[model samples]
Target: MARGFRLIFATSLLLMLLGICNGSTIGICYGRNADDLPTPEKAVELIKNLNINSVRIYDSNIQVLKAFANTGIELMIGIPNSDLLPFSQFQTNADTWLKNNILPYYPATKITYITVGAEVTEAPTNVSAMVVPAMTNVYTALRKAGLHRKIKVSTTHSLGVLSRSYPPSAGAFNSRHAGFLKPLLEFLAEKQSPFLVNTYPYYAYRDSSSNVSLDYALFESSSEVIDPNTGLLYTNMLDAQIDSIYFALMGLNFKTIKIMVTETGWPSKGSPKETAATPENAQTYNTNLIRHVINNTGTPAKPGEELDVYIFSLFNENRKPGLDSERNWGLYYPDQTSVYNIDFSGKGTVDVNTGGNLTTVNGTSWCIASPTASEKDLRNGLDWACGSGNVDCSPIQPSQPCFQPDSLVSHASYAFNSYYQQNGATDIACSFGGTGVNERFQPQVLIVYS
Candidate 1:
């Protein structure tokens, strides 16, 4: 066997043994906001290559459901915001959605959870107000279909749902959001599904890096952020963020619900103004995060419970809106190459598409493309998967040195560029050959190969 394959097989066996020993579950969000991702079938192939056991998608896309069938991977599918209004009002709508989108694929897809809405507290529209009722209705529908026991219903909320989160003990929900969040918390507790949060230390850092320690947010080793009331020291921002949610739940009179971080990541690239965005920082954040999970490190508040975190994305999303950083949180480029190597234990042989010019590594053939096209064009060109659409890896420095620590975004931005230059209007220059998305015009690259 090839050395790489042997390494992969050994690693895979070790991972499987460790998973069995640890019995921890990890979930990844499969957001499809961009257009350059692989088809569901190919996505399944990619996911299998990663050996991730659980995954979450924004919607019950039939193709995704079908693609994942019989794979033994657990899925958590979403009910979009638009459909919430109708589903909340009409049981029939919920029933039809389940019958059409869920029932047929069941037992085959191994779907375990259904997220009724995403961060409803942060959703722009009334999707927040309708979430509880929508969840209830959806739960009822699942029950009617005799699938409620197997599938749990829940909704994700943003950290914005909290009124104060500084001291883990003093955490409380916003008065305004309480009316909506209380009932939802009850439903989750009743169903025993986790309370999900999309926590971003980046936002806090960007809002006020002066007050927020870059070290704390970036998972750098440092003195803990002490929660005065509890007198606990928090070594990582992710734990503090989650404990804040837990404390918020306590304030609402529901303290037992499990809290899970549904999404969290560091952007590998960003606009000039986004100081913390960089490849090196991204690597540190993810690498530390993986180590944290592997060690089963919990927040100071929840010392024993294992944290289940899905990094923001598998690939940098080229088409997401807002700052240039918004689109660059992926761990890989569209061609299934590592953006910067971190251990994922993703080595396997599979059928390759011979139709296109492809790079055959193992049995998988990945397309080699640069993210030279505009974000819109990339989105249009690729099927809309969160990390699939834009930005290229082909132009990066020597592919052989996949794990070169310096070329990463965090090091490139913070260590290489001056503080003034980080926030300056100077167009980003490529130390390597490729372009990363920035504010003015974000370019995306999507290459699809079986």
Candidate 2:
């Protein structure tokens, strides 16, 4: 193991002068659909213990808003879709709603954004028409309160709003959503607010063909994918998805508006069919996700950008209807015990109990190129691994023990594994920009004949 280094984050004067230091600002979604959740006060304590200073709630619940007061935690509060029509048609409704839920808590509770509707595109009945007007009314209400400059109004959309996302450069919103999107984009651009999106690479990985791998979705890919059209390199699915949104917005000529990940997570457990949903994968996905966001380089399409990201949930909700995975995305169980340990601080491995004794699971893990990848891809991966990848190739050279009977595939596998092991044998290490994969097989014993 490489010797670990402790990182203390502090903003320097020079950086502030240059620009906003978009550094390490990861938030969590505080969903309360379950009956067994801790009280708002207790949940606040738990969140504080995790050192997460930002939060997003589905509604501006009074108790929650009150509990969060003076905590200095930045909040992104929502107005339920059910209230949109009333808030849209009547300016009085928007004012009254904000007066009741927001005015009393402002400056103390630190409410930063008011998301007018969440994924209204997926609502049971079409409420799309209510979104823009409600946002406008909400802005007016804030403007009336003299808080409009402090608070921004926007709506959340699922990836379904995009008609295409492959290659990322070709990303475009569905024609059916055009009417709703144009005004929304205009509003966001006018307000200098972000385009909120709920991107779940878990779904993309689960539903995709053989092209996308679990490592790719989890930000553990050592392999970076090159978008042919955009000429950008994507290291993981989340960035690809985010860049797709950027491309989609650019297609409409809305270039200045920022993007925020309203929700993104992997479930910790699932039914038999959801094989990818497990505690280890969940921990890996989120742990790496925190590191990725904290690295603060932003997506390939938008470099050096610092943006906020909210992990899907705080606690599992038994009441959420759908597959078991829907209810298992939480970092914590209802009782507040973690399903698996993760450091939001972005400093350690998934299992951070360094003071405790270690137990090794019985198996040998090897990183190799995926058999599913094309031979040309493997060759390309090999060339990169031996070159810029910094892998030693002497073992596969002529007269070496590993040389005879060797083919391009075999040499490539050896090089990929060598690089993977050298880099601590992580999922990211094995990825030759998304081409290499890991394989587990029994150790082989070479026999010699004299």
Candidate 3:
């Protein structure tokens, strides 16, 4: 019995060590704006098969809530803009909403967040006024039910709320919207909920494609744009956009408030004149995005911080209003076929063929912190790899062979590569909580067998 207990303990410890290097956390937005969609149960099954563990819905659909019960998928449910006024004016309405939409589904459904209204700033003036109040009422109602700490209450906003975004360091909210935003920010800060924003770099690139390089927006840029004021170098547009929000928050004295991307994606197809919108671009954007987020590479302004992100959608909403791009942002089609291949786990390279087949890539690779990785993240990763992962650290120790010109980046590289090689050289193994890694082939290297 003593020997058996020791074996079990050893196995559990090994599993825990391997689990520390698990893949990134990513979520998808489930928008039901069209007919011909699958039932909620089918949707939930599809989500699980894709290995995604988080989901956001546009409204509190009871069908979805009940279907998702016991699935262990974290959800961020929404309250439609139309219900904002009533929910704000009366606490009873908020209480009734909880009883109907939340209380029955609590614990079973794993609902983690409640968004009062999505893009409330885009609504009318009177409607915008109700957003904060509705959020407060919902929060109060949750407290009344003893679930306030378990679930968070907040709202989502669009990048349109920013009056300026260029240079990133100078970002600020539009003065015209400040009246509504100030109170909203205060509420979110008080509740310790993230400031959710619907950010789409596709729209920004499309609007100013002449100025914004296509490679930059797609996260494939080799060149960088340097911000004059902060001396920060931006390699991708997404990071620049996120940092702009960070700067805006800092300007408002809410520097501690976290930001979560509630919606972001590229369309797989678009109408004529939308040349940049193609399957190749969509696949590239989302693939690189998965890699970036999974690597935990924070924005240039705030390195190493892990930001929660949700891909725009699960299925294309055929009836969604606006340009054709509006209806084509899904990762999968209505028939549950992948629009393009994507590896949400960030474990391996996935090639999306024109014929809808995905192929795995194998090659020589190196592991190291990303150029923009935060110093703090590197130190933490270093500690985990050498201390707990049991990777040999002598080479990076004082006066060791690889210790010449010793630095965090240099030492981390040695440890990261050691762990990567020990773990079958998989991409997921290279991710040290967003410190970052690059995998490439080195044809010049030679191998000899005895």
Candidate 4:
């Protein structure tokens, strides 16, 4: 009888597992603070071409929503820091926002999440207290519109929320933040939403590069950092950073609530103070990160569970304030070119000689499109246009392909291939000849091709 019961339980669990596997989604943050950039329509085409299915914009720009229409990209739009005050005071404001910025674009644009305030609690300003209430109001508005189930509500937090994060097990929120954080966590758990976090190991390294192992922070081979309480070893800084959040959640008694890395990335360049921020290190960190995501490997605390992640900005925002690193977190430049090389599994390509649509080529289809292509090769193709020669086509070329050294497109191409190897595109093979081989043109901004 016990054996029969065990088998029944296993079957039920199997069905649940299948459901998650079939519907899991990956997203990217689309922070648009740059002055010179592509229009929303072109941006949508870029993302669609890359196969990125999800995006999180910092605000509800109508142009962006209109661009995403019928593209099937799952959007997560936000209420900016300045709007939180008015939103907290009036539920009507929330409702109006929905009617104005959301409802009009729904189903057609496919908005799946609405962040009330991104990293407000972690901000140095006094708006911290308004965050939770604003989120509540936003959730209420969504429920009123019958979008609660389709669109979850939450706010992103910075690592500044943590008071103690060393030894992993001892992670806890700053006592000052707990007043609002505790209740917010409760709301998230009840609503079945994830706790979003923006983590940057580059920040940690930049603060004190001498003490930190560059390889460790870059997600490369290193001595494991063990959690004092659990005695579990972590080989990568990302897992360690994530587990810190889990520990904090556990301390608040909301252990069951899922934690998502809404934003995590490395900068490609920086000033003297942020010297650790370099192109090579950025590639290493991101490459390892994508592989970690594909492998679905969890932290020491949750070994098998897949962690949801969204990389930082799609393009560098040159106009953003703060240190040099702030503008350098972009994976690509303003023109949709790559900043470094990294490969992502399930986003690579294979060449076939059979005549077929160019869009369906194994790796050509952007798995994460509507904004950024999910596969490394296609992303490399985009970068190749801008002359970011991060893609090393040396092996594939019959002779040395004349890459424009100063061209951003060349750098992007190299970065894409580098990203693939760093991520998990271990089995991908490049095709030299195919039906559309001649037509498969990389982006040529004239400097390289002309």
Candidate 5:
């Protein structure tokens, strides 16, 4: 059984990879703020199964680093904000960190980048001050270890660094942050490393939904916002955000430095006040985002340029502190199940199938409880399918025509199949904690059973 499952998983991954051919590669941020996440080894397997070739972790956990070994997935490891002070104060600290956290893995793990700090500008002034020096020290350590050429070093900045963002051509760094940003930009330009920035259109729209159109935030805007200064027509907020960084760099005469979006995504759920945060909206945002980035049709300011982007996260973090939206940006649930179906390939929507030799199914099918699954798991999955999933369970009610069997398995099978069909009819849609299975069935067959 395990061997069959592995074969199906491998074939599905291969099909996904084929669909992404020659398109822009996308990366995911793997944040581990939730306690329910799977082990690193399992997590790596899930990532591969999804055909994601790149990942960025907040820190270099040894278990995760070991799991990544031999996986051939490109990684961007990070140095947390708390470590910046010590790393900047002493080169020895940086060298020691490298020797312990990075040297042992190296080429085997495919570590391509090391972020010195994440959104350092959002930290205290002193911690923010350490960002550039820490990056310099880390770069020096990599050079001494003969790994400088292989690994690029930099820090991630928030969009807050820009004092003026509208009319992207006029974008400039906030004066208060200039003292730190000036030298940081110089080092990045000199080292030829890319500037990493986290840009979220969700926040912009959340703060002023009345002013910002939902279509603009989700990359579906038909009306354009023309920048008066440069006359560039902006269709989406993300592009404007990216170009603002470019103008800021140009202001400092660092025209040649490249920019990479380190983090960006929409939440699948949110508090009542967060009206725009919904699973459908997240699906639209991410699907459109993949198409936009992979098209390699860069922003209006930088057309036809290849830009690297990493989605904000992989799993919803239950323990993350902030608004409900903070914990809901993940594309997957803790069980590695997709929150909604999405095609990472630039191609059109494709169903996620995990059945060997059955890549595509045309006939009607129904999701039913797997005979081998545990009772507890089935019940839990049934509750979720009927509750949060918003699947209508009316057909399986006690007095309903389909409720004659009056068994947990029977009712659950009906509910599960209903939810699955309402979703994308994909393998993930039927994966209710491994308790559901897809089976081909005719309407007459179900009618006879009824």
Candidate 6:
């Protein structure tokens, strides 16, 4: 029976064990904080022009929901923090909330995730107690409606939730938010819902330019930075930011939960001190980011795993508070003109299959750590391949064919090859902090005999 199961597993892989950790979705955050913005009807037309299929709205305004109906555009609508108290107080309240916002146009509107609140940790008041109950209440309500299995229920948190986010691997949530996050993470794990975070590398780069470079923040870095603790290669700030969140999640012992970027974008304008915020930089960041996510180029820590993201703000909000950047994150001006020219149309390009299985050419290339690198560096590279690289290392396990040689170099070679292949066999995927080298080594499929 065990041998049969192994055969089934390998067969499933050959048949393409993808789509789970593949092809990310790109969505726009349709914030309505501004007064001069177009009507929901007109906004829908603009969204359609972008040709992207997903959108996230801050509220369940009937007009917005109604306008989006039947367009087949997936919507992520939120419940504000103010409502969390009421929603968490009773199952009835959650049911009522959903009844008003969701039940009306859900199937037509294609609502996917119902976020309980927006950045509640950053809310003026500490409604920490209510976050989970609200999610539970909302989830229960969805369950009662037979929609729990269909739509996800969660909350959006800012990067403030993490006390440490550097080096990607050392990511840990603030102990202050630990109590709140523990139950919340559990709830999400049980429901199999995603952990939503408003990830902004702009904030990171803005505050710490010395630590965060312009090229890195805008996804334009020519060279990769190695995470000393994990040895994973981070080419851009966004991936490093997201991977930090992944590491933080891992710290909590919840590894399988998916992460969704509820909000992320660079601003075209900012306070003079926010020097990095320029039209050119904004365009570069978003353009590169859109292509990065849609291309299924997962983070250095989790290659080939899609982290579906929503670009913040479809239109700039004149009414938004704070610094200049707060009001300047839109892809379009209030008049609906392009803030800066960018192509948001091409969503993703990951091919599902390459047809039948085969030998050398079919598998083609392999990746391994450079033998010339120092032993310490080689160890880091190998560690990254087997660790954050998320490669299947069973072939290097005890008694396996590749396991015979035994030493770190051999095992590391096998791991790098697997990680390389799993990640589209790209040159960067082989880059275990610049210590990786690509070679035309063909991989043999794992075979077992009953």
TM-scores across all candidates?
0.71, 0.74, 0.74, 0.72, 0.72, 0.78
Give the winner by TM-score. 6
Q: Which stretches of model 1 miss by more than 4 angstroms?
A: 1-23, 345-450
lDDT of 4: 0.67
lDDT of 1 by residue, 1-450 (tens): 476554543332222212222233456677777878767787778888877878888899998899999999999889878788898898888888888999999999999889887877667676687888889889999899898888888888778888888877888888987678777777887776778888888788878888788788888956867777877788877778888887777677675566777788888888999878988888888777766765544566654344677777876667899989888888777766777876643222211233663323222111211235444443332222112322212112232112132223322222112211222323332122222232221222223322
Whole-model Cα lDDT of every candidate shown, in order: 0.65, 0.80, 0.80, 0.67, 0.80, 0.80
Residues 1-450, candidate 5: write the lDDT tens digits: 676655544333322222221124579999999999999998899889878888999999999999999988999999999899899999999999999999998888999999998887787655778889999999999999998878999999999999999889998999988788888988987777889999999999999898889999999999999999988889999999999999888788777677899999999889999999999999999998888886555677765344778997899999998899999999999998999988877752233333433443224555788868888998998899878875545445554334545567766776676576556568999999889888763222111110
For model 4, where is the 10-residue window of minimal lDDT? 429-438
- TM-score of decoy 3: 0.74
Expressed as tens digits, the lDDT of each residue in 92-166 for candidate 3 is 999998998889888999999999998877876458888999999999999999998889898998998899999
Model 4 alpha-carbon miss at residue 195, Å: 0.7
Q: After superposition, how far is residue 266 of candidate 1 from its true place, in Å?
A: 0.9
Error in Å for residue 120 of model 3: 1.5
The number of clashing residue pairs in each candidate reads: 21, 7, 2, 45, 0, 0
Error of 3 at 241 (Å): 0.7
Candidate 6 lDDT, 214-261, residue by residue in tens: 888888899999999977788898898889899999888887678899
lDDT tens digits by residue: candidate 4, 346-433: 3312221224322222211111111132345554454452244233233122222223232322333333333333233332312211
Q: List the pairs of residues colliding in candidate 6.
A: none
